[model samples]
Target chain A: MSERGKPNELGEYRPLSYFQLMEVSLRELLVEKGIVSDAEVQATLEDMRARGPDAGARVVARAWVDADFKARLLENGTRACEAFGLDVPALRLVVVENTPQVHNVIVCTLCSCYPRMLLGLPPDWYKSRHYRSRVVREPRTVLQEFGLRLPEAVQLRVHDSTADMRYLVLPMRPAGTAGWSEAQLASIVTRDCMIGVAVPDTSGSE
Target chain B: MPQVAARPQYPTDHPSVPVRFAAGDRVRVRKTFPLGHIRTPFYIRGHSGVIERYCGNFPVPEELAQMRSGLPAQPLYRVRFLQREVWPDYAGRADDVIEIEIFQHWLEAVKT
Candidate 1:
């Protein structure tokens, strides 16, 4: 046994990822390194790949059209979810509304506590530690970097979702969606809108 | 009540069968004491918010790392909210909405 994960001065062993393991090529290396197995890795990837954006999309789509639904979301988020045909039995839910006055963004400091149910798998940026640590303190600058300019009048809020209560962004309806049907409204509901970075606009979405 | 472990290790990957919450679906975040490996941040717990976006289901990172509960990862959402509503008398900017990623395990139906 040479060693495992991090040699002191003589250079014995060290921790590694898949790419790293490929370079070393040692079965014992895997056992000692505790690398995630191919079976597990394959399963995780398959599981992730199997996930769809429809469930979360439907929630966002509904919020875009129904006023009463919006109100209910504000009042009782979990209950309101039921009106839209969601089945949330034991888990707790919280609603976060987006208005012109406030622009909200979310990040997970520990790992990534994403609203996957409503939005789907989080974008690459959301998982980056850069977005997680920085967004909480400097959200305005981050949003600006993402091409969303905010006014001095509008405040920027950063929420870190932990273990207890999960959050969602109820974006303000776009200017021209008054006559649009629910399907139409949902179509324009971009992931960014749900994230509160940009409002839903048909040009880019279409 | 069986005494819960102070902190337990999570699993790498488990099959997630989630029950989703749709828009206008009123919900509340149950206040749970910190336990095991989890991804939900520390700042937004307890405070109530609204559902903004329904992100598609995916593997929960903390769960995948085998650092938290073994519950299979499921679909999640990106909810939005007002800064004023979450925090009061805060004079940062006037207009700001808070968006977050909430999992299915932490949601409860809001009673009308």
Candidate 2:
């Protein structure tokens, strides 16, 4: 039954697809090495990705409208995020605020250490070693890959979170958001902006 | 006798510490010798700037990411920087912050 290719979600587990292929290879390795029951490892990884929390879009949207709450989130991310029960066992939170004179860029040097409690699963590119290695070596260049080119004067704060504490990049609210609710704003807070590749555009949004 | 591989003395689940710096304080990236494997990023390892903000603490990457089931570990921080400060050629873009994570030991206070 398992071999019939009726997996689940987004699409069936096709070995031709990159992620699926990788999973297949890992399963083979686990079995070949006698590390664990082949079925057990596969189920675990699938469950982690499937059951992970939804990107904390609700809170981000709320913070856009609620100043006091934003302040609290900026100060204590873990504690503030507790309201949503999105805490990771070994993870800490760092919320980088965007100001008129400063923008924030985040990168995980060692691996993909993201604040999954709020952001959900990381994008495929983030998992690539190129992004992890290149982001630290040339952040601006890497950002440019995502269509972001920062001007020279704006101070670039490069955050390299390589520990248990993960980071979230708070985007400056785009203008023309007049009367727009937090829910609407959070929808615009895509994973890219949170990672410092793109900025919010009120005139035209992502 | 066939050589048997010895297990790693320190694995990713090993315990670690909390960061020691605060937000709004000035910090410079210390010059560190690269090792066989490391979590310290290279771009700003030897640079200097003010700690525009303080992110929370977390476990050092040396032992966090690869944990089998993931371990309950230390906190991490999100340190901010001015692009102009980091790169001399950086032109004022009105808003450009380089937000990165660095553990406690990698930071040093800058004196006036």
Alpha-carbon RMSD to native, per candidate: 11.6, 9.3
What are the per-residue Cα lDDT tens digits for candidate 2 across A83-155? 6565545546667777776667777766777777567788888879898776654677777788887766556
lDDT (Cα, tens digit) per residue for candidate 1, span A40-135: 655756765655555555677777676788777766666777777876543345666777776666666776766665666788888898887766
Write candidate 1's Cα lDDT for B1-112 as tens digits: 1111111112223466644566546566667766766665555566566665554455666565676654566657655555566557544564555666677677666666
On TM-score, the leading prediction is: 2
Q: DockQ for every model, please.
A: 0.23, 0.31
lDDT of 1 at A41: 54
**Which ten contiguous residues of candidate 2 chain A have the minimum total lDDT?**
A1-10
* Candidate 1 chain A worst ten-residue window by lDDT: A1-10
The segments of candidate 2 whose C-alpha lies over 4 angstroms from its true place after superposition are A1-44, A51-54, A85-89, A149-153, A201-206, B1-37, B42-100, B105-112
Whole-model lDDT per candidate: 0.63, 0.63
